[model samples]
Each structure stands twice: as structure tokens, then as C-alpha cells.
Target: MKKWLIYTFAIAILAVLALQLFMFSTIQQQKNSDEKYFNMAKQEYKIFVPYIPDSLELFGENVPVDHVLVRERLENEIVRNMYWHSHTILLLKRSARYFPVIEPILSENGIPDDFKYLAMAESELTNAVSPVGASGVWQFMKSTAQEYGLEVRTDVDERYHLEKSTNAACRYLKASKQQFGSWTLAAAAYNMGGGALKRDVDAQKTNDYYSLLLNQETARYVYRIVALKLICEQPFQYGFFIRNKDLYQPIPVKKVSVSSSISSLVDFAAEYNLSFLELKNVNPWLRSDKLVVNTGKTYEINIPLSFSHTKLTENIADPYTIFKDSIVVE
Candidate 1:
């Protein structure tokens, strides 16, 4: 009996050891698998690339990095914009389409090239509407847009119209530059009202935008613009990479004059071989599917002759898919 009991006990102990060995092997295999996946995922995602320059310029005006606060402010902006990758990437992609339109307009109006950065800072180079009803790439408040000759109405909101709004922005910038005597101050005024900027300058006894101790948004405004300018110009340097195929392209469109109401934009788009959704996509200022025209007032409607790859229909499997040369509508 004692011998039988010893045999049973020994066998049970060996079985327990075998079970433990099996579990150990399984657990180790799982750990190895996890490590492999972790390494793969790590290779896919990168983090924290920023290039903080010692000095920078905007419209031929230099940021005096010699000042500790100014240098620190710039450093803050560089880090903020660089790591905030998603927003910055969208802005970069949109720049391919919008910058061509904005550049020529800026040059034509005698506005400094650096002012394009200001527009980017204002509205991310998009027709983004603000919390307080400021609209468009320029973030024009309805009142201010009207003051600059942008017609704001229920039916026709020109603030959302890119070219018209840009012209208005140039006029406003020119006026502000005349008032402030410096591009820096002019940009600062754009954010926190010319009156507020003037008050701050007078109170602080300085005309410099950086020197004036202002509110947070106004304070960081110039630094943000300058940082964006640097990162966008050298996107690869800051670890932002979009393949040429993935970048958004502008659609080629011809101007169509309309002196009559468009009762149904759906029908109007079909006439031009465009989708209703796409019509709004390019002409965002068209608030509704209908347009009511007044006598003697001719509205220029931009009818796209070609489609860009931005339209992501299921049939359009290729991300690089884009229409060839557009036919200009006479």
C-alpha cells in the first residue's frame, strides 16, 4: 500500500511540472508576439520632431531672439505646431490648392509675402467659421467683412468667397499697416482689434507687438504665424511627410456669369457635369442649393472643369486619381 501511494504521489508531481512547463512556454510565446507587434507599431509612428530656429523673419521684419521672452515664445510655438501634427498636416495639404490663389492676390495688392502666414494663422487656410461667427480663411467677422466691401447677406455672403474675401483682407491689412507703422503691429491688430492693440501699445509705451504685454491669444499670435511659416516651408525637416500623390490639388474651373436665379443648383451643376456636393465643395460660399439674383447684378460662378482626388467615392479606389486637363467654359 505504501509503495502504491508513493507512485501515485510521484506521478502527480511530474504531471504538475509538465503543466507548468506548458503554461510557461505559452506565456513566453505570447510575450514574444506582443514584443514583435510593439516594435512594428513603433516603427509606424514617430513623435516629437521640432526645429527651433535662433532667429526668423516675417515681411523682412526680424524676430529679436536676443530677448529671452521672445525666444521662449517662439520655442513654445515651434513645439506646439510641430507636435500638433494632424491640424498642421491639413493646413499643409490645403496650401497646395489655396496658396496659388492667395499668392498672386497678395502680390497684386502689394501686401507682403509673409502675410500669407497670417491668413494661415487666422483660419488654417480654410473657410473655417469661428465660435463668435467670424468666417472664412481670413476669419472675417460679418461687420468687419462688410466694412472691407464684402457683401454679407442671407443669400449672398461674400465673406465665404475666397477671392473677394482675400481682396478685402488685403485692403484691411493695408489700412492697418498704415495705422500701426509695422507689419508686426498690423498682424497683432488683426487678432485683437486695432483699437485694442493701440490701447495696449499706448499703455505699454511701445509699438512693438512682441514688447506689449497682451492677452494670451494676441501675445502668441505672431509666434504662431512665424512657426507655421517655418514648419510648412520645411515640412520634412519637422517630420511631416505627405506623398505627392496624397496632397490635395486644386480643381481647374472656368468662371460662368449668371444674371438669373439658380432655383436648383442640382440642375445647374448637372449642366456643367459636376456633382451637387462637389459644387459646394469648390464653391463653399454657395450657402444653399439656390441662388436668387437681382437685376443688373451679375454673379460670377466658378464652374469646375475637372475634379481633384479629394472626392473619395467607393468607385474611386485610387487615392491618386484625378481628372486630366479641364475644358474652359466660355
Candidate 2:
């Protein structure tokens, strides 16, 4: 009886020891796996801000970066971009696609090349819709779009039209510079309207946009633009790299003008040898299926230039369109 009892006690002690050993091994393996992942993340992704040109300064009151307040604001944006990893990566990817379209528009209108960053500040180069009803990559409100010669109606909102909207932005910037006498102030006015910008300049007795005490969004606007410009121009320093094929290319489109109303846009697109999706993809500004054109107004509708991949002649399994060439409808 004593021998049997001893055997039972020894077996129970071994079982407990084995269970503890298994638990420890599992925990150690998990810890190692987590460490490996963390190390990989650290090596693969890192954010770094590059050197910026003094001539292209944004929110410094035409003053240098020595001021304490100015330095702080700049630092805030740098930190924001560096830490907001996912958002910054997306911006980098999308910029490669959108910059080709935006750059020429800025140049033709004589707006500063640096103003391309304003698009990043506005909608991150996205066709974003704001709560106040602003739309498109440039984020123009209803009145602003119309006032700047963009057609805005229920059937057609040209604010969603990238080319026309960009041109409108250029006009506004030109007018603002004429009023405020500085490109920086013109950019600020783009955020806070021309009237408000003028009022602020007068009220503060300072012509500089950065010198005036403004609301949070307006105050941070220029700094954000400059930071993005710095980061985007030298993405290698920020650890961003992708194949050229992976980068987004723009679409090639042929513009067709119309002055009279059509019954169905779907049928109209078909007549032009375009699928309805193709028509909509090229002309996102067209908000409805039915066309209600004003007789006297000339509207530009973009049709995709036929390609071997998406041509009607090809046995393409899908009708989806891919943007390959940068074509503007201005």
C-alpha cells in the first residue's frame, strides 16, 4: 500500500512540471515572434523630414525661421507627417499620380510651383467632399466655383472637374495676389476667403498672413503645405519607394463639347463608342445619368481615348478603366 501511494504522488508531480514547461515555452515563442515583427517594422518604415529651400518659405511672415513661434508651428507639421505613417504613405503614392496633372495648370496660370502643396492641404489630392458641400481635389464651394467660371448646377458640378477647378483656383490665386501683394497671403486667402483675408490684414495692421493671429485651420494651413512639400519632394529620405508601374498614371481623354440637352447620358456615351462606366470614370463631374444641358452654355465632356487594353475591339473581360496618360480638359 505504501509503494502504490508513492508511485501516484510522483506521477502527479511530473504532470504539473510538464504543464509548466509547455506554458513557458509557448510564452517565450510568442515574445520572440512579437519582437521579430517590431524589429521588421522599425527597419522597413521610418519618417524623415528633408531640407527645405528658404526661397519657398510658407508661413514665416516673410521672416526667417528663427522666431520661436514660427519654429514651433513648423515643428508641429513635421512631427504630424512623420508620425502619421499610413496617411503620409497614401499621400506619397497619390501624389505621384496627381502631380503631373496639377503642375502644368499651376505653371500656365503663373502661380508659384510650390502652390501644388496647397492641393495636398486642401483634399490630399483626393476627390473629397466636405460637410459644407465643397467637392473635388481643390475643395471649392458652390459660389466659389461659379464665381471663378466653373459651371455648378444640379446636373453638373464642375468643382468635381479637376481641370476646370484647378484653373478656377489659379484665377482666384492671381486675383488674391493682386489684392494682397504676396503669394503666401494669396494661399491663406484660398482657405479664408478673399474678403476675410483682406479684413484680417487691415484689422491686424500686418500684411503678412503668418503675422496675423488667425483660427486654427487657417493658421496651420501654410505650415502643413510647406511640410508636405518638403516631405513629398524627397520621399527617399522618408523611406518611400515603389515601382513605376505601381505608381498611379492619369487617364487619356478626348473632350467633346455640347450646347444642347441630351435625354440619356448612357446612350450618349454609347454613341461615342464609350461604356457608361468609362464615360463616368472620365467625367465624374456629371452627377446624374440624365443630361440636362443649358442651350447656350458649352460643356466639356471627356471621353477616354481608345486603348488596346480597353478598346471595344479587344475581348477585355472587364470594362474597368485604368488611368495611363495625363490629359486635361481645359
Displacement of the residue 315 alpha carbon in candidate 1, Å:
22
Model 1 quality (TM-score): 0.79
lDDT of 1 by residue, 109-199 (tens): 9999888989999999878899999999899999999999988886778888989999999999999999999988989989999999888
- TM-score for all predictions? 0.79, 0.73
List, residue by residue over 1-330, the lDDT tens digit for candidate 2: 999999999999999999999999998767753355445546776545544444546532353466668767876886788668788878876876678888899899888788888988899888899999889989999888888898888888888888888899999999988998888988999998888878878989998666889878999988888778767766544444432333445566778888888789999988988888889877889989877876577888888886443343244222122112221111
Candidate 1: lDDT of 197?
88
Q: Which ten residues in a row have the lowest lDDT in candidate 2?
A: 321-330
Clashing pairs in 1: none
